[model samples]
Target: MQNMGGIFGILGVGCGLYIFYALYKLKSTGDITSSILLPKDVNPKTCKDKDGYIKAVAPKMAILGISTIIYGLMDLCETFVMSTGNFFWIVLVLVFVVLIWFSVTVSKLNKTYF
Candidate 1:
């Protein structure tokens, strides 16, 4: 179980970096609208300019990526702290809570922006 925490931490970091890279690509190409799966009520045509669309989406992407990175760091810290035989369960709970919060935030952003 302890080793698994480290693995998850590494995976989270990798996933977060990939998300950041995708956001960078979208911003550079000025094609954020096409990259996301927008809701039915939200039409891409509503966004008149490519720059504005990218600008709107970039912050959400950044928030998601940063939260993921923070989760990863917390996971790594939990792994080490567990080895010391202290506050293991508390840290684990915190990780799950953070993960849930991140998911909910992303879902809301998807509905609002995408």
Candidate 2:
């Protein structure tokens, strides 16, 4: 049981980082369009190029939220019994990093997917 918790924590961290990397790539390598999936700069400031940045951000944000919720579940499952010990920081950092990773990934993904 203890080992499972530790493994889950590490898995959370890894998943988070992978998602972030994917988003970063999306933001940097995509073609610009007037879709709400990416930032305004990709759409240009002209009327024909106008895209609702806020609208584009919704889906990506939702994905990030989903990721965070998953991460919280991972933490809760791991912490159910062994709530204290030397591995506290591992669990703490893992959860927090999961959030940061997903947020970054989502931001970039929104531009591409929206």
> How much does candidate 2 score in TM-score?
0.36
Give the clash total for candidate 2: 5
* TM-score list, all predictions: 0.58, 0.36
Q: Compare the candidates by lDDT and give the number of the best one.
A: 1
- Model 1, stretches more than 4 Å misplaced? 33-49, 81-114
> Distance from true position, residue 96, model 1, in Å?
7.3
Residue 61 C-alpha lDDT in model 2? 42
CA RMSD of each candidate after superposition: 4.8, 9.8
Cα lDDT of all candidates, in order?
A: 0.64, 0.50
Tens-digit lDDT track for model 2 on 1-114?
564555674565565555555445435543233332345554333323223443454346446545644664556555674455545556456556755764577466554544
